[model samples]
Target: MNRLTLISLQVLVAVVVLVFWHIASTTTLIGNPKTISFFFAEPLAVGKRMVQWFMEGSIWYHLGITLTEAALAFIIGSLGGVIIGFWFARKPLLAAVFDPYVKAANALPRVVLAPIFALWLGLGIWSKVALGVTLVFFIVFFNVYQGVKEVSPAVLSNARMLGMNERQLLRHVYMPSALSWMFSSLHTSVGFAVVGAVVGEYLGSAAGLGYLIHEAESVFDVTGVFAGMFVLMGFVILVDWLVTLVENRLLVWRPKTSVISNR
Candidate 1:
């Protein structure tokens, strides 16, 4: 389907869901809808709250904190992940030695780690950044590792026969070959980065959209909760778009797949 058609379908689905939600909440037909917080803020109420925030200036401050944490996490985590992945992939023995340890670290509950990070970094933006980094690192690491390992033995043999040095082979063969997989993980990392930052903030920060949502929940401000969630989603979408742009630039050598019938 075309973009327009997809957009129209999404809108229609959203509207239908909203209408059903409003009717169920406003009337007693569905039983005690007031018992749950979800029923309190219908689509219109959430939209109004979102508009109010847009009208006011508080949104920027929260948004800025969230964005900063996410960007930092994305950069630091991606860098660490790529380095570790490359190192381990090149040295299978070392990778084997650390495999269980790495799995253990990845298995640990990240939410539990948030409090420790908060203690180490303090109840500030850095705490959230650190939390987000942990969430993002493993994802990129595994993808890059797998991508590097997937390089064909025949390709390596050909490059070696052509007298390619270790450095030259890595630059021309492994790195370029892994670039697509790296970016694929990076796209997912972006979303995890946001979640880590927000959840960390919700657990204990004084600022950030997550904190706002936490505060709103404490006061039973369903509209505020929805507004914060919507804003976080918008930010994630923006970052994802930016990642796609970068991917397009870097992977310019790759051929585009035919999509529309006209092509």
Candidate 2:
């Protein structure tokens, strides 16, 4: 489908869902109306709470805090991943020495590290950023490692025959391949970055959307919780779209597939 048609359908689907949700919560269209409304909260109520939050202007501070944490984590984790991944891929001996340790670290449940991070970094944004970094780093690292290692041997030989130095080979061949892989994992890493921040906040924090949701949940305010969730979803979608734009721009030479009209 065309872009406009796709967007229209997406909006229509959301409208239909909201309408059904309203009906189910307001009437006996599904389970017990009281239970449904109590558990899910009315979509209208969630929207109202979201509006109130925006109008109160307190949410901006929380948004800033969360975004800062996520942004820092993304940049740091990505850089570390790219550097280490390239190093390991280039020096198989070094990789062999650390391979088991790296795998073990990656295998560890990041949630367990939250308490340690909190102890070290305190309950401030740094703790959350640390958590997010751990989550994002491994993703980019693995992708880059695989990308560099998978470079075509024939192409590498050709470059060597052409007298390309190590740096030249990296710039022209390895970088392009690794970048493609790194970008592929970045979209996923963004969500994990957000999750790390939010989960850290959820575990312990005085501010952030996660804190807001936790507070609402503590008070049994389902509407507030849902509003916080919707806000988080909205931000994630916006960030993901920004990533897509950057990816498209940077990978312009990556080639594109043609789309022919069905009609």
Candidate 3:
């Protein structure tokens, strides 16, 4: 669909949903309408609260801290994943030996590690960053590792026949083969990074959008909670869009495939 058409559809859907929600909450048609205020605050009220935070409130400090923790975690995790993934990819023996260990680490629920991170890094940005990094690292690592492993044997032979050295092979062949997967993991990792940072804040810490939301919940301020949530969602969408832009730039040589037809 054209951009205008898509936007119009989205607006229409949103309006329909809001009307339905308002009716359900104001009437007894759905039963126990009193619970609606507890579960689903009206969109208009949520929007107004969001505007309050956006225009007159001091939400920027919290946003800044959350963004800092997420960004730091993303960078650290992606770098570590790439290096370790590349190392294991080039050394099958090591990959085999460490596969179980890696799986075990990834399988462990990361939330359980929050307290340890808080203990080591304290209830600061570092703790949140550590949590986020733990969430992001394994995702990127596995994708990169699989991407490298999936490289064509024929392509490898061709490069070798052309007298390419290990360094050249890695730079021109292995790395390129894994770039798509790496970017894919990165897109997913962005959300995980945000989750890690926010959940860490939820668990402990005085700053961050997560903390703001937590505080609001503690006070039964549903509108405030929704406002904080909307702000975080906005940031996540912005970062995801930025990642798509970077991916497009890097993968420009790759052909595009559109699933949607004009008709």
Candidate 4:
């Protein structure tokens, strides 16, 4: 289908969902209005609360904190992943020695680490950044490791024939190849970075969108909870969009494939 039609359908789907939700919560379409409102929250009320938070400029502080945590996690985790991944990929004996420990660490549930981090780092942003880094690190690491390992022997041979040394080979071959894999995994890593920050904040923090949601939940303010969730969803989408833009710019050397319509 065409892009315009696709967008129209997407918008229509959202509209339909909102209308259904509004009817179900505001009327007896699904259940008693009061009961529905108590559980699901009125969409209009959620929207109004979100607007009020934005209008009063209260949301920006919490949003900024969350964003800061996510950014730090993304940067630190990705760099560590890339560096370690390159080292392990180049040294087979070292990779084999540490492989099991890496897997064990990666397999550990990240949520359980939140309280431990809070204990170690306190309730400050660094705790959240640490949580997010754990989530992002493994993803980028595995991707870069695989990318470097998958570099074609033929390509290496050809480069060596051109008199490329180890450093030259890394600059011209390994870095570029590993970067493609890193970028491919970044979309997922970025979301996890946000998730880690929010979850850490939710577990224990004075401020953040997750803290807002937790506070709302404590008071049974379903609308506030939903508003916080909506804000988080929007923030993740915005971050993902920015990641996509950077990915496209950096991966421009890669080829693009287009489908041809038989009709």
Best lDDT among the predictions, by candidate number = 4
Let me know the TM-score candidate 2 reaches against the reference structure. 0.93
Stronger candidate by TM-score (1 vs 3)? 3
The TM-scores of all predictions, comma-separated, are 0.89, 0.93, 0.91, 0.96
- What are the per-residue Cα lDDT tens digits for candidate 3 across 28-141? 888676788678776778888888887875888899999999999999998998889888988999999998999899999999999999999999999999999998899888
Per-residue lDDT for 108 in model 1? 95
lDDT of 1 by residue, 127-236 (tens): 99999899889988998898789888899899999999999999988987676677756677888999899999999989999999999999988888887888888888
Tens-digit lDDT track for model 2 on 1-263? 89999999999999999999999999987888789988999999999999998999999888889999999999999999999999999999999999999999999999999999999999999999999999999999999999999999999999999999999999999999898888866678888889999999999999998888999999999999999999999999999999878877876776465101100
lDDT of each: 0.85, 0.91, 0.87, 0.93
**Number of the predicted model whose TM-score against the real structure is largest:** 4
lDDT by residue (201-261, candidate 4, tens digit) is 9999999989999999999999999999999999998998998798779878766541011
Worst 10 residues of 3 by lDDT: 254-263
Q: What total of clashing residue pairs does each candidate reach?
A: 0, 0, 0, 0
Higher lDDT: candidate 2 or 4?
Answer: 4
**What TM-score does candidate 1 get on C-alpha atoms?**
0.89
TM-score, model 4 to reference? 0.96
